[model samples]
Target: MKITVMTADEQFITLDVDPEESVENVKALLEVETRVSLQQQQLLFNGKEMRNAERLSSVGVRDNDLVMMVLHTSAPSSRAPTNDLSFHPDGSAINPGAFQQHVRRDSDMMAQLLQRDPALAQAILGSDLNGLQNLLRERHQQRLELRRQQEEEMALMYADPFDVESQKKIEAAIRQKGIDENWAAALEYNPEAFARVIMLYVDMEVNGVPLKAFVDSGAQSTIISKSCAERCGLLRLLDQRYKGIAHGVGQTEILGRIHVAPIKIGNIFYPCSFMVLDAPNMEFLFGLDMLRKHQCIIDLKENVLRVGGGEVSVPFLQEKDIPTHFLDESRYSKQGSLGPGSLPESSGAKEKNDNMPTGSRSSGTTLSDPTRGPEFEAKIAKLVDLGFGREAVIQALSLFNGNEEQAAGFLFGG
Candidate 1:
């Protein structure tokens, strides 16, 4: 059989060998071909780590499979076999237990990094961080830009209160898609910005108590730290032991039980899966498998993850609505003066006011008002409630095409 190996350095090594070769033979061949020590490197097929003990059966090794080699550069691995350690027995002979101890130490470190950040570990195991970091950073930037585009798309998706005819035009456009007003509205987020993306946040629960997580989509798998698992009251149910080594990190033992909680994001709820990692640096990580189901809109260019069924507008600073110069002085200081930083008191006062707690802000508004039900008597009450500016309510309802439940999700993503 002919085997091709892809190194982390973007190099490829093709070897003609027997199909019965053990994975250890491939590693040794790779070490000889690439000058990377088998004990100091890990190999992967596709995206998963490949063990040296695996045999290259026809199903396991085939042509065109992406075989990657990751070289170990830093960090002491307790998993890899090393002969650096020795202990003198009472007879002054070298004890092999020292080598065992080294292997044990490396195993522990590899476990830790895997549990803490499997994706990062995957990168390290690939013997490449630069490529992975660049990829993630690019993804993040795209998310930010996506948010900006969403802001620009709001007028196009929703009928503006001030633009009645424009509103009708949008309704007409979506109506042509064979969609009802409600369904259209539910999916009416800016396609260029909020379409075809799934964004999620981590919600950890300890005995059913919710915990907030700032999710990083770049992460590969869920990693819950030991302390967090303890706090969440997770008792160790089993040991998911993995033995491999990554560069510049330690190993870990992942021990925790699965806990489910409602993850609410912009009118979306996901009951999720979690794994406990023993890293002190990590709180929790949400992986990619769960995100593929929902319709997610991520503005990678905007640095914001809009979870589901709503527009997440990324704020940008622009010059607009500046107060006209208050040439009237003592009588009219409210007219505003100076440039971005011309007035010291104005800036300080502005900062002080900004620092104060905001009363409350919801991501959305109610369809009518909560106090008013669907009854005729609630009509007047509804109108009264709409007085908080019925236009806003209309806009929010328009967001859901009138599905108040979803609209509430977008509006009150509290």
Candidate 2:
């Protein structure tokens, strides 16, 4: 018989199972299919919780029946309020029906109260109204004290900027911090600074297998997830003594380097080296090392990744077309830029340059030009908001000599 399983995220999967199979056995099958552990799965059938020892037939499960599975970090609480009550504080008998109705009216509040006081959970289930009332009062008092302490801490942190002692303490704390402190400070003071650039991704092939790759200019070296390498059968054990560490925002990890790894994008095939990291969340990253070597240009305006100076360009997959697992939706926007500088201007810019005398333009071009100043940052941010990565947008603008229309065209493949 086939059973349809639905997850909390609304993902559905169909499984064939024996009539005598237990709920735990079904969970084992789900673990293999979904990569979710059995312990985290809470299976429900017909609005009733399914026990590990319960048989499918015993639970009256039919073919193609839908079973709901909720994933949680911990087991769900089984406590529930009953239609019974205890004596009140004044030695008066509480009305069982009224107390039960109150608990039923705000089930979420009662659940929170039970979570804060596990000892009171049994009292609630057993209808010990007086015990539950006392427990709730104590929990409320604890929350009040916690909130007061948090408020005091916030007040001290935001004390008068002109207060020398407080400012000195703040400076000292910042000085003692690591790289994450700077990121936090930037997030707090200059959110737009980081928001100007967004992550870019493209579809590429590795050993004839389609793979999604993140385009990151800031990464010193190309990196591939160990899982991807292994899945592609490209992972070869390196010398044990050649271990190295890779540092990124807020974290660092040891990596195993692989050389001469071939990656194919469109018609071009490039043999590059990559540092293999155990990055499960991100499978592939095409870093500066590969981009520079290929003279690759990511045209956000054209919506393509050009190789060999536009000799060959592959259009990127639309956000919706890309696999849900491959992209981090939270970090990207859906809006796209259509205005000037949002298209490619390769032809126009080249024509203008050809008309000008050689060496007429300044020889000095700084790496920071595309990303510098409020106007440039604003343009990049706007393009990013339109669903393009900041680096790709900046690169397109630079390629077109800051022509917004050309960059935008380039991104949209216009």
Winning model by lDDT: 2
What digit string (tens of lDDT, one per residue) describes model 2 on residues 45-101? Answer: 999989989999999899989999998677543322221333344322245445445
Model 2: residues with Cα > 4 Å off, grouped in runs:
1-198, 237-240, 329-414
TM-score of 2: 0.34
lDDT string for model 1 (1-414, tens) is 577676778765666656766676676555434445567778777667767677777337685556777877873644433333322222111323443233234543345446644664455356343554453345445534654554434557665667978777666656644544554565575323322122233333434545545344333334456676667665453233321111111124445436554444434456665655544434555444344444445555764455443343222212232122211111211222211111112112111122223562212111232223464233333433524345444333332223344333433331
Which residue runs of candidate 1 sit more than 4 Å off their true CA positions?
Answer: 1-212, 236-248, 256-261, 266-268, 301-303, 309-414
The TM-scores, one per candidate, come to 0.23, 0.34
Q: Give the TM-score of candidate 1.
A: 0.23
